[model samples]
Target: MNNSRLISLLGISTLRAAPRDVHLLYLSRFLRTAAFGSTGVILAVFLSGLGHSDVRVGLFMTLTLVGDVFLSLVLTNWADHFGRRRTTILGCSLMITSGLVFAIASNYWILLAAAVLGVISPSGNEIGPFRAVEEGMLACLSANYDMSDIFAWHIVAGTLGVSFGTFSTGWITAIFQKPVGWTEQESYRVIFIVYTIIGIIKLLVALKLSNASEVSRPTVERQQDAEQEEAQPMLQSEETSVAKGPGPTALMRAVRIFVPELTAPTRSILWKLCLLFAIDSFASGMVAFTLLSFYLHSRFQAPMSLLSSLLAIPFIFSAASSLLASPISKRLGLLPTMALTHLPSAILLGFLPLAPTIELACVLLILRAALSTMDQGPRAVFLSQVVRPEERTKVMGVVNTIKTLSQSAGPTVTGSMAQAGNFGAVFVIGGVLKAGYDLALVGLWLSRRALAEHDDIVLPNVNDNLAENEGESDGTSRV
Candidate 1:
């Protein structure tokens, strides 16, 4: 009975029942995050080794995120209409490009250009349109109730990948330097080389996704949209001959661009959610794991290997904590679970800088880790419940873009502070902002009322097949 309960709570059935495509998505995320994790550990150290100042390192992160913001906005907005698979492939390709360039080049301007033009993660967080697109796909790929379970395992895969990457990268960095007499930059480049290879593997994995992962659109409607596409430019071409105000064609096109992607009701709820998320993410950006690792290294003189081992603890604990998210959300509801668990974690973050010893800081971080990430699965489930299938991708894109835009400045702020010897304030301010954001979510936004509770918005159109994707099966649950 205990074993049965454990399997049920862990949602082992959900994993076993998931389709191959869903599994592919999970694998892609795991590989991507492993690359991200390794880079997170080494990026600051690499820049420092390159003789860049703290502020330059911070600016590098800021620009990386700013570039990410634009990239995410464009790709996510086009993903549903253009093709999810293509978007993912492009993203992976960009990751490969960024990793290769960073591995080969040491020039700051060149590295910054590569980062801005392609995909690289300095904060060790998801940094592209992949998350938004995948979340949208995941929402449609499974039952609404199973969403949280899928997300839980997804988080587990990601955290474990991070743990593996960070731990491995640390050892690799140390090993390469020990007897090989390799310089610090050479050691770090090895990780980026590995990152580039992971991107290739992920790209191959992404190519295997079945049509079941894409959003369903009607066949005739697709034909219509395609036909309209070929004629839109010509239609707009006639604007030169038209009488004032550009023309009807141009005006309608402009309106379409200006119109909100979501429905009025979804907008009403989601705008607030976006704002709260932006605030929370800004706080997160302030203490990105890379910066945190930098702080430890600079302040306590922690070695790279030891620093990575210490930093990886939270991801492991966070992964385990995510397993509890589904059940906890089921009991406490998503928002309540998110708010209640997060507040304490934020408080712990507030106290992190106060720790006089690394051991105490790790203890506080472990405790904070146990709670900080418990909300992810619930939040995914909540968004899936609240947003319609057609709008999910854009909604995620918009929200994530907003969050990234807000977060982009945080590392710079933290960087400036570290330059001034006020680095410790980053954690304190981040914690307080995060705590207040959690409260505002419940208090000002009334998120505790549970948007999913007011009306149980469910997805029921997984079979809305496309003509081009004619033979693709839904890849329904297994035995």
Candidate 2:
């Protein structure tokens, strides 16, 4: 095809390939993340203003993570049975309640209760069940499109939303404090009110999702019929014997109903991925953007407005990196792309505490941000590709839940250390641990690839399924 015609065709194909639900999902992620980003920037500052010490601040953050871990585990594991839209709306409602409590409540115990029982993002990132279910839905909906590109755009949307929220909160607080004659505490409360409004909007958007967003469940009868049809001649007698044996017990049937049955290889890969991810998440908790903001304020006595602008820089770089992730993954492969980009960022984090001036620290932070999140898109795509279709939600839920559990420990320890005047140690510890995770990930990927090659096992290509689906559709040309 000629160059002009080829370019036009590609544009049309891309537009046609994206479903309405995927676009809505992106919009919902942006709105929800904006709320999280804004609250995360101010959560620690607001709590400390309420006369709580640094240890209490850290304890609150840890409890918030524990609540999220529990809720996410239950909601995501049964999302297929309960319906994704319903679970997502329920999560949004919890966020709304959390926001309201933060906006109005002043009692320390009351706020702590709200933090522990309600959905909130103390890490300035996804902390509820929304991500696990949404990722599974996006993977299913984008099966016929460019999976990497779709995943890249999703992260880009979230990063940009977070950037806007972080930057705006600082300015908003400043404005409210000066012209509006509000105290710093009151100004922060206004931000939480905005968070509540955003949650309401997200809830409405989630409600608009179509029935196509529901998870696909396979029935036992259909599985049995397919197995019978595919049985080989030599295996027919064995299959019949098994089928004729006593039916599964009540406990086994319940297990099958709620839990997905993954093949042995898929299960093994899922467990390894979860372990690696938990290590990274635990490190992340030590320097969660929320706690990091608190650290900057307490250690350097930086102003909130300045801190807000500095924090936003990383999200901007992360957004740009997210857009570039698809092409990078295409060139470098998923595992390599994840490892190469992440290692440098972790090394940069190790140097953050050594900067003598705020300006130098901000510069290092921006550079780290540019490289840190480049793995997000590729990692999501890798997980989606490794598991069976029906197992996607379950696997994503399990991984996310375990990661949250691992991360919950970091804040308590870091908080106590910071309270004890060991402010610089957390960054060094987090950076070193993350760097170790990156190295181990690379080793695992190499070993797995070698074993697959040695055994002559062919892995499925993500794009091959898209091409096959296109061919099966009506004879319209595809790019």
Residues 81-122 of candidate 1: C-alpha lDDT, one tens digit per residue: 788999999999999999999999989999999998898888
For candidate 2, the lDDT comes to 0.80
lDDT of 2 by residue, 1-479 (tens): 89765533333344356899998999999998999899899898898898988898888888888887878877887777788999999998989998999899999888877777787788999888888899988887887778877778788889988988999899999999889999999999999999999999999999999977775444223333433443333243556557866333434445544354555556677778778889999999999989888888876888888899889988998998876777777777788888999999999998888988888888889999999999998888877776655556777888888898889888888889998998788898899999999999889778867877887654434353332222222212111
lDDT on C-alpha atoms for all candidate structures: 0.81, 0.80
CA lDDT, candidate 1, residue 25: 85
Q: Which ten residues in a row have the lowest lDDT in candidate 1?
A: 458-467
Query: Which pairs clash in the backbone of model 2?
Result: none
Worst 10 residues of 2 by lDDT: 470-479
User: TM-scores, in order shown?
Assistant: 0.88, 0.87
Candidate 1: TM-score? 0.88
38 Cα displacement, candidate 2 (Å): 0.1
